[model samples]
Target: MNNPTRTIISRRSRPAKEPLSKDIIVKTALELLKSEGSSGLSMRKIAKALDTGPSSLYVYVTNHQELSAFVLDAGMESVVLSNEEGVSWEIRLYETLHSYLTVLMEFPGVAGLALNTIPIGPHSLALTEYILERLHEAGIHSTSAAWGLDLLMLYASSVAFEQASRAENGTTLQAISASYRSLNDKQYPMIASLQSELITSDGEERFRWGLEAILQGILQRQSKFGI
Candidate 1:
């Protein structure tokens, strides 16, 4: 029995950091986003910018995708989602979409974050829920209500991406319009005809048109459902 003695050892495993905290990692990543835009925000670069080992960042963010999500969530916090005084869904919808556009525009790198994905995180879900609730109040059916929100997100994000792309390419709205005008009329006649109107609008006007079109679709559904 005395010969059956044993020794025990203990070990510790550290868990990773969550990037949700408003701290140096997030701050540095945002600075990188501002300086380099979406493509430029890499883990290694962010680590370098923050003067930390890349592995530390890995503990918090798995990759650029996660980083993008984090950025969009944090950036979207700037959006104010609420009703205008006694406003109808049409007007409320307009105000909401406008606020969303302003939020993404605030951090120009943000639109790139939400380009095509169905956002499901807490922040994104909150906004989506708000939009759907408004649509439901507008008498839109559940199916159309869901799709309308999708369309609105796509249109606003796409426009924001386009504006960011043009700015990156050193093109102005006027220059873009002029370039459109230069296209051959023999082909793309519709585009050529509408080219001026197309490029002449700042992103805000374009966003309003898109938002209104989506709202009209919602209204069509609303009328059908209301009856």
Candidate 2:
């Protein structure tokens, strides 16, 4: 058998010459994550990647959880949020969510971190504020907007995690399509009948459709609330 190609974040042979810092640690951790996934990340691995002792890492990050939190926030900072005026609230909200999901997809390991950690980073805070503000501006009720943001985050993170997990398992979505197509028609007539439509998306079509459906549902409810 041929050797599998190894893909790492950075091709450089040497670690960065900069002094040890939280930024450096977080960057190195991200690089490690790109190659190793969440399960492969640890203080020892990070320290080794940085050519430092594991104990020294404690000065920058208190523990694994804190380090993971930092990584999560760093990923959030990479998302570019456009707060341009005059854009429809629906468009702005959709763009913000798409940007957030794009960032998480780029750093799949961060999906794990996002789900497990609470982010207070400036970028994360800004995203939350932007979403709430846009929703309220759209005349969505305050309560609905708050819950809507939560629901959106949950959906985005879970989607990112599923994509990452499937990639790591060396599984293709075709497997899912095959399984659905093979289900017994007699036992699950509706699912079996709809299998073609259910499994036919070109990856992003379904995500976009789902996002629009969710936002439309929320907006319909907001209209009912008369807010």
Candidate 3:
């Protein structure tokens, strides 16, 4: 029954913490975002996760807004840009956008950041460049291509955000259907008549239809306006 001996551990034997850098900070922020959504992306939470003071993060990131942009772009690194030699520009563009939507849905917080933050990171630039190239191949150039790029990204981000919100709030299509069913047909004839069609397709089908519709609109506008 001798007294338990305490063993002293040398600090030098402990594993050294990884050096802080912009890349590490962005990566950590992305992890937090994935785990806890947008709320987890605060400077204090990130610093705590890294076992450092919140002020230490300032050396790498200018502010939370800038870090958000970095985190959004880092999340976009997974977007697959198809470069198949034989694929049509339309198909490639659709696939690229689908890939982008998939990435946003996977990282729901990133969708919110994409809507709010102006991404300037290399990955974001690459995605934009890829979309622009496809649009250029389709004879969409100058202002039309630029505007189309913005429209495409906005549509995808918005859809992702909407889905994320629904997921977080435990909303369902059935709930919407039930609410629509309760509407007064006399007061809302169109909505009452089209309720079935409105909720018919699954998300993937609706998303594809939206992408095609937007592409068609852009093409029509470019043709009519010659821009």
Q: Which predicted model would earn the best TM-score?
A: 3
**Candidate 1 pairs with clashing backbones:** none
Kindly give the stretch of ten consecutive residues in candidate 2 with the minimal lDDT sum: 7-16
What are the clash counts of all predictions, listed in order? 0, 0, 0
**Against the true structure, candidate 3 has what lDDT?**
0.91
TM match of model 2 to true structure: 0.82
Runs of candidate 3 exceeding 4 Å displacement: 1-4
Q: Which tens-of-lDDT digit does each residue in 91-165 have in candidate 2?
A: 777777777877887656888887888777777888888888887887787778888888878887888787777
Clash pairs (backbone) in predicted model 3 = none
Lowest-sum lDDT 10-residue window in model 1: 13-22
Best by lDDT: 3
The true-versus-predicted C-alpha distance at residue 152 of model 3, in Å, is 0.5
Ranking by TM-score: 3, 2, 1
Error of 2 at 215 (Å): 2.4
